[model samples]
Target: MERKKNISMAVIRRLPKYNRYLKELLRTDVDRISSKELGERIGFTASQIRQDLNCFGDFGQQGYGYNVKELLNEINGILGLAKEYKMIIIGAGNIGQAIANYTNFERLAFNLAGIFDVNPKLIGLKIRDVEVKDIDELAGFLKATPIDIGVICVSENSAQTVCDMMVSNGVKGIWNFAPVDLEVPKEIIVENVHLSESLLTLSCLMNDRTYS
Candidate 1:
């Protein structure tokens, strides 16, 4: 049966978990895995896993299950991680530097093209071998170089301004780490990451014994 397209995001979000389980199975030299077995490894119901996979069309046999390597490639293509994404970071503060140094970016097909900062002191500095250029050079740099995404890690006060600059320079997607919400045009995709709220949720989960 064809799955409804309305719940695409929910299915999309589960791909990473499925990929992780598949990777483990591959490491163990498992050639094929039943939906029930895959779900057991990832804490999901077999039916749910089957339904999610059905959204991308059937890949499993009636009783044999799915091919581990084939499923991995399918999920990678679905998540759009099959190709590398060129990205740049705006702001050279701790968060930005951490992102520049993060090894997960390369694993997830995100390449840190460069870093930008408004502070004269931070400008010309190097983080993870990527030089921090002045914010004023954003447009010119973008014009000459190819970057699809931007990571905004500026302070709350300067967040919107920096976002505006990034948008003006033709950044399609933005990973915003600022506390304040930004007002951007409809064409730009902005993803907000609230560190404090995430910590608060983790603290609450840790303190609460009833959370399943």
Candidate 2:
């Protein structure tokens, strides 16, 4: 299973769409589904799906297809969704509050522990049952609580500083929403979500076809 674990990241990324299609099939009582049929639902070719799944052990039979529930569990396990992950948001701004209140993460085994903000007036606020605390308490709170991941939504000016603080607090992974790129130690994993860049790309696509 060395090779399986090696390609696990790519496989995990595709699990959501695969699980979505599998859920639809399960609703129809589809006990077994062929790679071709699964491909049609997600726009992937049969060969591609087979190759990706091949990294893991064979799940499909020679004549029949894969069991719906079995495949769902396998994919979920590979994606680390089989276990819940505790996370905290490091900003109480519009984007941060929206993310904290988002229901999507709940389905994927992620629990929003709390939200932090520098503003005193917003510190005691609640978003989707998760209380907002002062940013000053981040280090202490993290030390006391069980938080594996942190979502950074501070301003661009303070992005690096906030990221540094999070790293110092022993956060393993960070989802950065600031416009500026952050510099972190090699051990920390940082995923930047540049909303403006995505919008600009879409605008360029619509306004000018040259880039496209």
Give lDDT tens digits, candidate 2, residues 1-212. Answer: 22355675666578778878888888999888888888988999999899988887777886787888998888777667778889999889899988987898988879998899998889899898888999888889878886778899999898888888778878889999999888989999888899999999898888887655
Candidate 2, backbone clash total: 0
Best by lDDT: 1
lDDT of 1 by residue, 42-98 (tens): 999999998898887888898899999999988877777879899999889889888
Top candidate by TM-score: 1
Colliding residue pairs in candidate 1: none
Global fold similarity of model 1 (TM-score)? 0.89
TM-score of each model, paired residue for residue: 0.89, 0.88
Q: Give the RMSD in angstroms, all C-alphas superposed, for model 2.
A: 2.4
lDDT of 2: 0.85
